[model samples]
Target: MQMEPIAIYLFVSALFILVILKIKTTNSSSKLPPGLWKLPIIGNLHQLAAGGPLIHKVLRDIAKKHGPLVHLQLGHVSTILVSSPEIAKQVMKTHDIVFASRSQPLSAKIISYDSANIGFAPYGDYWRQMRKICVLDLLSTKRVQSFRSLREEEFSGLATLLASHAGSPVNLTQMLHATMLGFTSRAAFGKKYQNQEKFISILCELLKVGTGFNIADFYPSIKWLQDITGLRTKLEKLHLEVDSLLDEIIDDHIADDNNNTSMHEDLVDVLLRVQNDRNYEITRNNIKAVILDMFAAGTDTSATTIDWTMAEMLKNPSALKKAQEEVRRVFSEKGYVDESNFDELKYLRAVIKETLRLHPPAPLLLPRLSRERCVIDGYEIPQKTQVLVNAWTIGRDSRYWEDAECFIAERFLDSSIDFNGNNFEYIPFGAGRRMCPGMSFGLANVELPLALFLYHFDWKLPNGMKHEDLDMSEVYFGVTVRRELNMHVIPIVSKPV
Candidate 1:
């Protein structure tokens, strides 16, 4: 019954030819970039539906025809898709502040404690305070370095398990994902909590709905439909459930009188200490939101990156042989691979970099919203417009790369290109003020397990499947690119030299 007015409005809007004409005339003079013809109210939403809901592939195809910078109207959301490195520089570097604030989606609002977390928080004082704490206390070099021993212990445990299953087909994806969770759980919430699996399952469910593109996000005017569509109700339940769980964890920490005197502090301890301090005004919700960000994002993305890296290497045999050889030769000589000497494994680093280039964990690298109307390269961008820099497309663009589609780790060996935000050509972790602060921690999650996986055993495709036959296809539903099929492989023990 409540949707009747919206239904009538939609019916009436479809026949408002005069309104469409007026918009066309205004847009003609305003110099909007080229995009597909839009329909009344729907505004290319139907077109995107017809083409397929995979916005990454849809936008990439549109950019191929309309040029690197293309305009789109996803419902009423004014969107600009940037597919080239040059335009990426303009958005990420030149006019970063103009596009710094995120357009908070409805799902984000429900799940992130109303965008209280750093990743989705609108650019402002609260975001600044939270980010500073994360950088200085949680994600600082000293903090990340402090977690080195913890990572080594987790990696060793995983490697031992894999070795026992040598000469058998194992679900590398499942194993790696579980181990990464344990690793992240320890770093963020002290030891692997008794409810790590429950927390992980709940978090994953929340992310699936939160990160997905909801109808409400496209047509926010009908935001009440978020409940109509059932997304909000589902998220609200999960939010309460997750909140209860986090509260228990924080309560346990509060009960620990010795936490203050302990030499090592987990992220939760640090946040609690700050909360108790008079210098910063924070609540328990803020602490939980921050830790949620640490868990969901810090674990999932690195695991996705590792999975894609393994898939890509499997598809390209020479790269796999080279990566495994480099890991084994470098680490075997030292009798073990640890953080202090891990830096010496240059090729492994390059493989990780190359993997980031081809398959960035967040392909669109987080959507940024235009704070005010601005012009970029003569195209007028209206305030509140969504700006998505296609990091995946940019990474594979031939203009900046030679043999761009092929997996070649050597390109990054002795090369200047890096994942840091400065170099526009490659921004797997993104750039500017909103660039991911957890890069160090995320990299540690990916790099250590990846090196161990290579060093501990030789991996092969199941059932005599040739490397060329392995599927490198991806799952690009929203922003992240995960493997479409599970990467099942048999692990063989590596012979000692």
Candidate 2:
């Protein structure tokens, strides 16, 4: 029994190896989807890591070499990556219910109140109830339109600020981020809090950590790895900071309601009003979680879309000129850009669509979990498998798009393809029951800001940089992807508001 420490360690390692081998042997009989050769213990993790930080791009490459539906064993997690629209339809449409639930990663559980929020909640009664509340009360077409005045005010403020900096190099990225934050804060909490900037900064950090690529998420059985990596501690601290802010927000809303001093019912007011209802009984944490969902899901995504659209247009000046011309022409009679005239700016809409096609904010969308083992495309997907639908790859597939790699806004002008998830190849917002429910709200935020920027300013690269020299590289941050570098440009007042 008096063994050396090295002997003990070696014995444990041998046992772990045996267990891994046995598991692999057991699954060998099943008809799993095609996958790259994997090693024991770590599985396909090394391949993914080598491919780079952009998991979608790596997955795309793997799919090209392997098959459309690729099975990857990431540590103890069994994952299925769907690259083509055909397979994506099978997983998201044909067997939607079986894979409707979300894969609860460690960071998501921590930041989203143990997956209580609509965006990450498990598929069940609670998720259904939260989604119903969100669609009906918070994100309905009528509710989004009701916030039109707030959107206009925030964007108009941006136009004014940019106008002041006209002819000077302006950090359009920072301005757009601020504008989105102000709009989201007002829409969600009735007024922008003094700590809104802090909130956004912390949120950005959380997004980076919660990308579902954490070591702990891969090896769930090895719980100590979370602490070893300092991920658990970091997530807890972030959760505390975010939770405290949410608590303060809720307390302010409650105080306002009690005094009857609130002018109108914001999202917080609506959540509080239904807190005690028999049919939709929700706790305070639920309310905080939902409101955080609004900020997390609504803000960065719209901002990223607007950012990418501008970047893409700048990259292709011809598209930029066409979009600008349409924006100015359609809004000329109205004297200012508004959502009402957005319909007439067909080229502008096309530009946005093309941007989305090329660079989806959440390229992989949210990962879905399988509730039951099902056969997809003649291959068996085991129960509890995590599914990643590669929207970025599908959008760029030449089979679906003529010039998939190029930013051609005119391609969408006469095409019937849309991003409503019905068209699987163009599912920028995802598909099925788990599809993004805040589409209207998000689009409102994106369209108005983009139109305003186009209408109020003519942009040029700083230092007389050629448009071709613009860096269009993207940086992936958790669920959303955005420009790698902050866009810097000079704004010349085009049509002074």
User: Each prediction's Cα lDDT score?
Assistant: 0.83, 0.87
Which tens-of-lDDT digit does each residue in 1-497 have in candidate 2?
Answer: 65788899999999999999988976763589988888999999999999888878999999999989999999999999999989989988999999999988888788888989998899999999999998887677778888888889899999899999999999998888888877888888888787877877887787677654678888888889988998888888988898888888888888776532223568888888878567787999999888878878888899889989989989999998888888888888889988887788888889989999999999988889999989999888989999999999999999988878999988999989887888999999999999999998998888888898888889999998999999988787667888999999898998986
Give the C-alpha miss distance for residue 308 in model 2, angstroms.
0.8
How high is each candidate's TM-score? 0.92, 0.92
lDDT of 1 at 291: 89
Candidate 2 residue spans exceeding 4 A from truth:
1-30, 258-263
Best by lDDT: 2
Q: Which residue pairs show backbone clashes in model 2?
A: none
Give per-residue lDDT, candidate 2, residue 43. 95
